[model samples]
Target: MLLYIHIPFCDSKCHYCSFNSYVDLFHLRESYMKALSVQLAYELKRFKATPGSIETVFIGGGTPSTVRPELYRPLFETLRPFIKTGAEISSEANPNSATSSWLEGMFALGVNRISFGVQSFNNEKLKKLGRAHNADDAAAAVLRAEQAGFKHLSLDLIYGVENDTKVLLAHDIEEAFKLPIDHLSAYALTIEEGTPFASIPDVANEKLALTEWFLKRIKKRFATYEISNFGDYRSKHNLGYWEHKDYIGLGSGAVGFLKDTRLYPTIDVQAYINDPLSIQSELLSEASIKTEKIFLGLRSIVGVDEQILSEKEQNRASLLVKEKKLIYENGRYYNNDYLLSDELALFIEQ
Candidate 1:
C-alpha cells in the first residue's frame, strides 16, 4: 500500500496554485502535526495494514519544509513500528524554505527522496509566478539537499508560460541539468479557474512545439517514463497511483483509494485539525476503475492490459496499432503519442 500525508501550510502562496494549502497558518503547525499523528495511528489500525507493508510514503503540500522538522519526530517514532526496510519516503519542499537544517532533519527522520518546486531558473519568471525563492536560492537549496545525503532529488519545471521562447525553455533545461538532480517533471502552465492565471488565455496548445523541443533535448539525459515526468529515477509514489494500488491518505486535503472506495479528508484546515479522521469517501464502480486504468495507462508507460478492453475496443486499438498510433506488444496496448493518448483512449473505449 502507498501512503500520502499532506502538510497544508505554505510560507507564501504561488499565484497559479489551487491546491488546498494555506498561507499565514504558522500558528497551527504544531497542533496540525499532532493531529496528523493521531489520525495516522487510527487509520493504520482501522485499515488492518502494517506500516511496513506500505511501499511508498509521500509527504506533500503547501510546503512541508516550512514546518519544523523536529515536530515530525514523534510521527516517525510511531511509524517505526510498522515501517519496513527499503521503503521510499518522499516529501515536497519549496526551494526557499528547504534549508540545510531542514533537509538534514528530514533525512535523519527517514525521508529519502526530495521533490523541490523549482518552476524556473529565471528570477523574473519566478517573480511572475509569485514564487518566494530566487534563482540562487533554488541552486543553493538543492546543493544543500545533496550534501545532506539525499540520492533521490527531483526538480519540477513549469513550461508554456505566456510568450515563453525557445531560448527561454532551452536555458531552463540547461540550468536544470547543471544541478545534481536525478528526476525532472516538466508541466505546461494551466490556468485553473479561480487561480491568478485563470483570466489568461491557455498557451499550452501553442507551446507544443517548444515542449517537444525541450523533451528532445532533455530526453538525452532523462527517460520519458511518463508524459510529464522523466528521469534516471522514477518515483514509486507516483507510479503507485497510476497503477491503482491501494493507499492510505492522511491529513487534510489528502486522498486515499482502496479496492472500491476513495477517501478524502476534510479540506477545511481548522476542521481537519479538530478532526483529522473526518474523511469523506466516494465509491468507485467497476466501470469507473476500468476507465481510469485506460486513461492513466495510456498517459504513462503503464500500458493497458489486453483483456480489460472489450472486443470492439480491442479492434479499434488494433486499428490504431496498424496505423502506428498505438503499439501492441507483450500482450498489451501502449500509447505512442502523449498528446493524442486521451483522444485515442476515448475513441477505443467508445
Candidate 2:
C-alpha cells in the first residue's frame, strides 16, 4: 500500500494555490510533527501494516522542505519497521527552501526521491505566478540535489496560463532539459473555483495541439507514462492511486483510500494538529468506483479491463476503436489520445 504524508506549511502562499498550507503558523512546526507521528503510528496499527509491507511512501504538501529534516527523524523511526526495504520514499520540496543541507538530511532519513516545485524557469513567469523562488534558485536546487547524491529527481512545470505564448512554454521546456532530472510533471494551469486565478480574466485550458507538441518533444528522452507526467522513472506512489490500490493519508488535507471507503482528514491545520486521529469518511458505491476506474484508466497508462464494462459499454468501446479514438488489445481498451479521454469515456458510458 502507498502512504502519503501531508505537511501543511509553506514559507509563502502562492497566488494560484488552494492547498491547505500555512505561512503564518511557523510556531506550530514542532507540535505538528509530534501530532503527525501520533496519527501515523495509530494509522499503521489500525491498518495492520506489517513490516516491509508498504510499497511506497510519498510526503507531499505546502512545502515539506520548510520543516527541518531532524523533525522527521522520530516519524521515520516509527515508520522504519513497516517500510519495505529499498522502497521509493519521496517528498515534495520548494526550490527556495530545499537547501543542500535539507536535501542531504532528508536523504539520510530514507527519502530517496525529491520532487521539486519549480513551476517555471522564466523569472517573469515565476513572478506572475507569485512563486517565492527565482529561476536561478530552481536550477541551483536541482544541481544541489545531484551533488547531494540523489538518484531520483523530478520537477514540476506549469503551462497553459491566460495570455501565455508557445514561445514562453517552449523556453521553459528547453531549460528543463538542461537540468539533470529523471522525471517531469507538466501541468496545464487550471483556474480552480476559489483560487486567486479564478477571478482573473481570460483564464482557460491549454490548446490540445500545443500540449501534444510539448509531450512529443519530451518523449524523445522521457517516457509519456501519464497524461500530465513524463519520466524515465514512473512514480510508484501515483501509479498505485491510478490502479486503485489502497493507501493511507497521515495529515490534514490528505486523502486516504481503504478498500471501498475514502478517508478525509480535517483540512484545518490547527484542528488536525489538535486531533490527528479524527477523520471523515465516505463509503464509495460500486457505481462510483466503476466510474472512477473507467475515467482513471482512460487518462493514464492503465487501461480499462474489458470485463469491467457492461456489454453495451464494451460494444461502444469497440466502435470507438474502429473510429481510431481508442486502441483495444489484450482484453483492454486504451485511449488513443489522452486529450479525448473524457469524451471517449462519456460516449462509451452512454
Candidate 3:
C-alpha cells in the first residue's frame, strides 16, 4: 500500500497550475493539520488492518515546503503506526520555500526523498510562469537539500512552453545535469481551462512538434523510464499508480483508489474541516479497471501484457516489430524506444 498526503498551501499560485491550493492561509495551518489528523484516523478505522505494510508515502501539495516544519511533527507521529519499515517517505518542495532547516526537519521526520519543483533555469521563463524562485534559488535549494542529508532528490521541469526554443531547452537540460539528482520529471505544458495561462495565445501545432523534438532529445540524454517521468531512481510511489497498485489519499481534494472504489473528499477546505468523513466514493466497473490497466501499461517501459491484446492486435504488433517500432522478447512487448509515441498507441488500438 502507498499513502499520499496533500498539503494545500502555497506562497503564491503559478500561472499554469490548477491544483487545488490556496495562498496566504497561514492562519488556517493549525486547523488544517488537525483536520488532516482526524481524516487519517477516520480512514484508518474505515479500512481496518490496512495491510500494515505501506511501501511509500508521498506528501505532495499546494506547497508542502511553505508550511512550518514543526507542524509536520504530528503528521509523522500519526503515520508511524501504519508505515512499514524502510518505507520511502517523500515530500514535494518548491525551490523558494525550501530552507535548510526545513529540509533537515523533514529528513528527521522519516522523509527520505525530496522532489523540488524547479520548473526552469531561465529567469524569463520563470517569470512568465509566475514562479517565485529564480534560477540561482533553484540551484541553491538542491545544494541545501543535499547538505541537509537528503540522499534521494528529484527535480521537475516543464517543456512545450510557447517561448521554449531548442537552445533554451538545451540550456535547461544542461542546468539540470549540473545538479545532483536521482530523479527528473519533465512534462509538456498543458493549459488547463481555469489556469491563468489559458488566456494566452495557444502555440501552433508546429510549435508542439518542436516541443516533442526537444523532449526526444532530452529523453536520449536522460533515460526515459515512464511517460513524463525520467530518473536514475524512478519514483516508486508514482510507479505504483502506473502499475495499478492500491493507494490511499488523505486531506482535502485528496483522491484514493482502494481495490475498486474511487474515493474523493470534499474540495472545499471549510467543508472538509466541518465534516471529515464526508467522502464521495464510487465503485468502478470492471471494464473501467481493465481500460485503466491498458492505458497505464502503455505509458511505461513495461508495455501491456501480450495476453491482453486480441489476435488482430498481435498481428499489428508483428508489423511494428518488423518496422522496428516495437520489440517483443521474454514474454513482453516494448516500444523500440523509451519515449512513448501516442500515435503508436493509438494505431495499436485501431
TM-score of each: 0.97, 0.97, 0.92
lDDT of 1 by residue, 11-122 (tens): 9988889998889888999999999998888888766776478888899998999998899998888887676789899999999899899999999999999999999998
Evaluation by lDDT, superior candidate among 2 and 3: 2
lDDT of candidate 2 over 151-211, digit per residue (tens): 9999999877665677887788888889999999988887776777778835655777787
Write down the lDDT that model 3 would get.
0.83
Prediction 2 global C-alpha lDDT: 0.89
Q: Report RMSD (Å) for each prediction in the order shown.
A: 1.4, 1.3, 2.2
Q: Give candidate 3's TM-score.
A: 0.92
> How displaced is residue 121 in candidate 3, in Å?
0.3
Q: Model 3, 89-128: lDDT tens per residue? A: 9999998899999999999898999999998999998998
Worst 10 residues of 1 by lDDT: 199-208
**Consecutive 10-residue window with the lowest summed lDDT within model 3:** 201-210
